[model samples]
Target: MVKRVGIRDVAELAGVSISTVSNALNRPGRVSDELVERVRAASDRLGYVPLQAAQQLRVGRSGLLGMTVINIANPFFADMVAGAEDAATAAGLRILVGNASDDIAKELDHLELFERVQVEGALVSPFGPVDAWQERLRKRGVPVVLVDAVDDAGVMPSVSLDDVAGGRLAAEHLIRTGRKRLAFVGAREEVRQVRERLEGARAAVAAHPGVALEPIWTSTATTQRGLAFGDELADRRPEDRPDGIVTSNDHLAMGLLHGLIARGIRVPEDIAVVGYDDIEFAAIAEVPLTSVRQPAREMGRAAAEILIARINGTETPDLTNVVYQPELVIRASTSTAR
Candidate 1:
C-alpha cells in the first residue's frame, strides 16, 4: 500500500516540531508568519493535504455545497457563481468554489476534495471529459448537477446554453448585414462548447453559396491575444481581410476591434465584429460590442436549485437538460444597415 503523507513528514521538512506544524496549519494565529510560511512551503512540497481536507466528514454533515468551474477569471463564470451563491444563501447553505484553472487534473482534484469535505451536493462545470470521475460521486450517493454542460449519459441533469444556435445567430446577423467573407475566431477547439459553436457557424456558411467562413484557431481567448489577431488582420491587404468576424467571446472581439480601429480600419463599413457571452463590459466598450447573450446568472441559479433539491430530496420539475437559448444583442460594432 502507498504510505500516506503524515504531519510528521511536513514537520521534518519544515525543521519544526510536529506541534508547531499543527499549530501553523490549524491555528495560524498561534504561530509567527515565518513559521507558517515555512510549514506551508514544506506541506506543499510534500503534496500534503490539510487535516480538515484529509479528514472524512463526521456523521452529521458539512452544510456546504461545492462548485467547480473551468476558469474563474471569465466574468461569465463569475456571474454564474454569484447566481449559485444567491440560491445557496437563500437555501441556508454555504458554498465552496473549486476553480479548475482550466486543467483537467485540477478539476479531478476538486471533485475528490468535495468528496472528502462531504459536501451535500456538487455543481460541476466541467472543462474536459469527467464521466469516470463523476461516477465516484454517484457511487457515494452524493448528488451532482452538471452546470453549463450536459451529461452525455443522460443520467445527471444539466443547465446549459444552446451554443450552436448562438453561433448560427451571430453568423446569420453578419451575413444579413452584407458581410460575405467571414471568419470565426477563438481558442480551445477541443472544448465542446467552442467546437459546437464552430459547427453552427459552418452550417450558416454552408447555407449561403457566396458567403465563405474561415476558422481561425487561437492559442487562448484573451484581450491580448485578440489584440495580436487584430494587428495581424489589419496587416493583411484590404481584399484579403474578412468583412465580418465572429469571435467565441467578447474579450477577443473587443481586443481585435480596437486593434483594427487603431490601424484605421472602419468597423461595419470595412469589417464588422460579433462576440459571444454579452458580459458587462461588452455593452460599455469604446464602440459598444455586439454579442450573443448567455444567461449565465440564470443558468447558475437553476443548477444550484436543482442540486439543492436533490440534496434535500425535494421535488422538482423535469430537468434532464435545462437548455437556454441564446439572444443576439446588437450594438455599434455590428450596427451598420445593409
Candidate 2:
C-alpha cells in the first residue's frame, strides 16, 4: 500500500518545524511570506494533502467559506465569484456559493444553510437590507462581509462599486455626443444600485440643461425586461422615442438593442445605447455596446479578504468600506454617426 505524503514530510523537505508548516498552510497571513512560500513549494512538490477533517478538529473551524449572490446567472456576479474563488484558494480555503436568483426568501434560506454548515465566514451580495442576517450570523460567531452593497450603519465590512459615478459617466457620454433626449431603464427604486444610478443620471442631466432623462422603471433588471421595454418603445412614434438610452446592466441593454434592431431601428444613427457593468457579451453584440465598467472581480476579492481577516481574528483597520471607481468603455452602440 502506498502511504500518503504528510505534513511531517513537507516540514522536513522545507527545513521547517511541523508547527511552522501547519501555520504556513492553515494560517498563511500569520507566518512570514518567505517561509510560507517555501512550505507551499515543498507541499506541492511532495503532493501533500492536509487532512481536512483533522485540521478542522484541531483549529475548531472549517476550511470552507460561503458566498451568496443575488444572481449567479448574471455575468457581473459570475466575475465576482471568480475573483473570490481565486482569493480564497490563495489563502488555502475553498468557497461554496449559493445563488439566490434575486429571491429574498432564497437569500435567507441560503444564509441559514451556510449557518447550518458552520462556514468559517460568509460573503453576501444581498438583495436587500442584511442587518438581520448579519446580526444572526454575529450571534453564531460567524463573520459576514457585504458584497456590492453598503451598510450605512457601518456595522459590517463591505466592498462595492461607485454606481452613481458609473451612471453619471454613461449619461455624460451620451450628452456629450449630442443625445438630448435620454432615457434610463432600470428596476424599481427599492434596488439600491438602480436608484443610485438613476440619481446620478439625473444629476448629469441637470448639469446639461437641454438633456432630458426619461425614467423607465421595470419590475426586474433582466434581458427580458429590457426586451419588453424595447418593444414598448418600438411601438411609440419615432418622434416620441428617446435619442439615447442607458440600461442598468449589459444584458438588459443587449436585449434592448436586439429588440430595436429587429424592428428596423438604426443604432447610434437613431438611438444610442449604453449599459452598466460592461459584461463580456457587451463586446460581441450585433453592435458592440458602450458601457460603464465596474470592477466586479476586484470587489469580490476585496470582500472575501475582509471576511477572511475577520474570520481569522486578524485586525484589519478602517477597511469597513471599500468603494471602487467606474470607467466608461465606448463602443459602436454609442458611437455617433458622422
TM of each candidate vs. truth: 0.82, 0.82
Candidate 1 per-residue lDDT, tens place, 1-338, comes to: 98889999999999999999988987899999999999999999999886553332443667789999988888999999999999999998878999987788899998999888788899999988867587889999888988988888888889999989999999999999989999999888877888888888889988999999999999888889998898999999999999999999898998998899898999878999999999999999878899999999999999999998888788366855799999999998998643
What is the Cα root-mean-square deviation between model 1 and the actual structure?
A: 8.5
Report the error of model 2 at residue 95, Å: 0.8
Worst 10 residues of 2 by lDDT: 53-62
- Expressed as tens digits, the lDDT of each residue in 1-338 for candidate 2 is 99989989999999999999999998999899999999999999999998885878576877888999988999999999999998899999899899988788899999999998789989999886786588889899888888988888888888998989989999999999999999999875677888899988999999988789999888887888877788898999998999999898888899899889988889988999999999999999999999999888998888888888887788368787899999999999999543
RMSD of each: 8.5, 7.6
Measured with C-alpha atoms, the lDDT of residue 175 in candidate 1 is 93
Report the poorest 10 consecutive residues by lDDT, candidate 1. Answer: 50-59
